[model samples]
Target: MALPAPTTAPTTAERIRSACARAGGAMLAVEGLEPAPTPVHHLLDDGSFATTVPVDSALAATAVSAGAAGVHAVLELTDHAPLPLREPVRSLVWIQGRLRDVPMREVPALLDLVAAAEPNPALLQVNSGITDSGTTTEPEIRYALLRLEIESIVVADSTGAESVPLSALLGADPDPFCAMESCWLQHMESAHRDVVDRLASRLPMTLRRGRVRPLGLDRYGVQLRVEGDDGDHDVRLSFAKPVDDVTGLSQAIRVLMGCPFLNGLRARGV
Candidate 1:
């Protein structure tokens, strides 16, 4: 069965950026090196991305060795639901580009750029125990910072796969609530199964037979994952209109649940 598309779907750039914004970790593959998985990464205001790897790891060593002339690399980021499901991954973003080390002198500036996106505590430890006298107090652990210069990007999801232009990516902004999507979806799954059931009722009868779980939420709508005897299916329920903030999102969700005046989400910081 053909899944319904959102009436007001997010643009490809917005969707790709949103996926990256929510991704907790990504797989880094440098040329001639084994793919390394790192939980520490941040997308900068520019199209490039910054990531930290253990100082002693081969990936870090490769960055150090590559020096001014960087190595070709690809970073694969997956967007998945926080809650467990038959298929957790909703989308995959592959970033292809050059990878090189960010000099220690410039690390602070990089951190500032990432801080605007997420004030991760790991940023503080990235440059630990270094003194003003140009000396070093070796900390228990040290990390090497590497930056990826985005040459091209490709995004794939249930709908299909396509390459997004760099110009569009640089200009697009992720959904305002992308950062809160995981928390909101998880809350619905755990605290309000009835809400999920009501939304699932809107799906076709074939999908209703399967176990339905919340997959994603955006200004446009909510997506559900259906796990059935055959396989998994993704269905989107677009809002009557797109919402831009929490109040509008709450109203949209309540409308989806057939209770426009409901106050179930306001107390929870929806």
Candidate 2:
């Protein structure tokens, strides 16, 4: 059997237009959020501006006024479905109101928009990409982007990691911006340069394995100095992904501190 679209899938925008026979209507003031709870600002068209909620709202009133009738759902097609059941969605959103700036974006989490809209429940677009550094969820943005063709939305630049607000990302400026980890190389010879140098000078040519003692490994890596008849070497070794972070270095350092021979040297502040 075909997967069930919600038991109460909302009429399409075309259907809504036909039924209402109106160009653009309803100042559906969802009372409850802020004194004027931040108004739902989004572009009506390419140039038109409007709002879903009143401007001077305290933002607290939205909780009480927005009843259970929930925002309706609208569906449209994008690319061919990769799987039998999954159709690529472009965007999904309820026509709340015409606005100049609405907290919306092209992200992943917006899939929740599709699932939530089915129940016909008041879908609070809590994610404001900026001006509000709130919780982070990928799915919300995904679904929001899906409904952009028909539903009115306004997007903003990404604020990286310095998210301060829990509501939106647009209009918010983070002090320091952090991006995703781009690249990494495991077991880098470069990071082990010091240990390599130390070990090189000490490991004699054709050196036979002498009596073995269990020194210790540390955050820096492995600081096990081998005392062969040739010479003694205070060395550290590391084997870890190379990119950026304290893991390898930490292990190497720990090795220096934990190794009995090194510990004795360190205890004497050597």
TM-score of each: 0.87, 0.15
Error of 2 at 121 (Å): 31
Alpha-carbon RMSD to native, per candidate = 4.8, 23.3
Q: Ten residues in a row with the worst lDDT in model 1?
A: 260-269
- Stretches of candidate 1 exceeding 4 Å from the true structure: 1-7, 131-140, 260-270
Q: Which tens-of-lDDT digit does each residue in 1-270 have in candidate 2? A: 886543221113322222122112222333332112112223222322222333223222332233332222222111111112221211222333312223334222432533342221222443333434665544332111111122342211111112122123223221110111001111222354454344444445443264222232222233333456766433334433221344444443434334454323455545
Residue by residue across 1-270, what tens digits does model 1's lDDT show?
997854677889999888877887788998677787666667676768888766777888888888989988899999887889877778899999999999979988888878776876666667577788978788766666789998999999888999998889878888999989888888999999999999988999988999999988999999889999989998889998888999999888888889855665444446
Q: What is the lDDT of residue 176 in candidate 2?
A: 14
Clashes of 2: 83
- Global local distance difference test of model 1: 0.84
Residue 134 of candidate 2: its Cα lDDT?
A: 64
Give the clash count for model 1: 0
Instruction: State model 2's lDDT.
Output: 0.28
Best by TM-score: 1
